[model samples]
Target: MGKLLTLAKEIIFPSRTTCFICGREEIVGEDDLCDACRESIHLCICPPAPLPLDGVSAGLLYTKELHEPMHRFKYRDKVEYAAFFCQYMSIPQDWSIDILCPVPLYYLREMKRTYNQSELLARRISAIYQIPYCRDLLEKTRNTATQTRLNPAQRQRNVQNAFKAAPECKNLSVLLIDDVYTTGATLASCAKELKKQGASKVYALCACKTDN
Candidate 1:
């Protein structure tokens, strides 16, 4: 009887998928995550110390196992992974956030990638939470070197003056969304611009964080 039910489920939902992290089929649970992969995820128990942004929150710790999925989502056209990643995100209950703003990509890079991964993640989060999201709230004015190889100071300098906030962001309390938070230089730079444009508060949220 159980085998018959399983077979019927498979036939009815042929597009039912595997775990996003391990690609394990037979995900007999919620959210397309296998038990092992779900158990292995290291969620942030405590939020990071405040930076230029009011606060920071992340869903998972950056681990070697997460590298491939993150890379594929960002650069390998695996946009479908956004839903899996967004499922783990948690917004602060105390934050009176008015909008969601994705950390923007420079035009050339965005064009080359065909889509901004951060925007995709942010939009999914916005849809889930029913919060308005604007991709144009922040704009990357210059193409900078990737932060992956940069030291803390270099990362700070690389993104400095790289972002500009739009007029529409003025006086809005925003939750800025991104894929990863490493040195936090990118988020800080963006926060500075948003504050300059009269945003009341800016909080950062990311899918993954590295120990720094």
Candidate 2:
């Protein structure tokens, strides 16, 4: 009876067994990508960390193939997609991160969305890597314009003074988690606030990075 009930549930609301990238049902791996789509994913070979970030890494290069799914994950309530994305994020051996801090969304924005996508990624990463995560440590204080259409300098200005860090961040090494790394503007702004609150080091990890 239990098996029959479970099978009914599967039939009613299908599980995410299909490849997230190509929607292929054939032998999808644990990351939710079939062999062909998985091979097509371009891993990010990051350059040196920009100012204020001690280190940085990302899982995939943000290609056109990934854009649709990523948009859905962020804006279309595809929250379950966090599990598939976090599987590819790896923490570097050198950074002694004390806590995972998701780059925050403005309270109103989060309230409207019902969840912060970055926080979802951070929680999954913390569970997988056995590292603690603290959403209270950093906060978005301002509802800045979205960085999507902004140029590099404009992106920097948009997030300036947009975040505040808790005093508890003092002396701790923090790893900032976000869905994408584009201009490094948002992460750097968040890192600056953390440092001002006395954080010793800051690093960043993202699900994807634009190939620009």
RMSD values, in order shown: 3.2, 4.6
Q: On residues 2-104, what C-alpha lDDT tens digit does candidate 1 reach at each position?
A: 9999889878885446777787675446767777777777886545645669988888888777898999999999999998788878898988889999999
Q: Tell me the TM-score of model 1.
A: 0.89
Candidate 2: regions farther than 4 A off: 1-17, 24-27
Find the 10 residues in a row with the least total lDDT in model 1. 43-52
Note the residue pairs that clash in candidate 2: none
**What tens-digit string does per-residue lDDT give for candidate 2 at 1-212?**
69999999977875656789887676675677888888889888887877899988998899988998999999999999998788778998988999999999999999999999999999999998899999999989989999999999999999999999999999999999999999899999999999999999999999999998
All candidates' TM-scores? 0.89, 0.89
* Candidate 1 local Cα displacement, residue 45, angstroms: 3.1
Off by over 4 Å in 1: 1-17, 24-28, 46-50
Worst 10 residues of 2 by lDDT: 23-32
Q: In order, what lDDT does every prediction score?
A: 0.87, 0.92
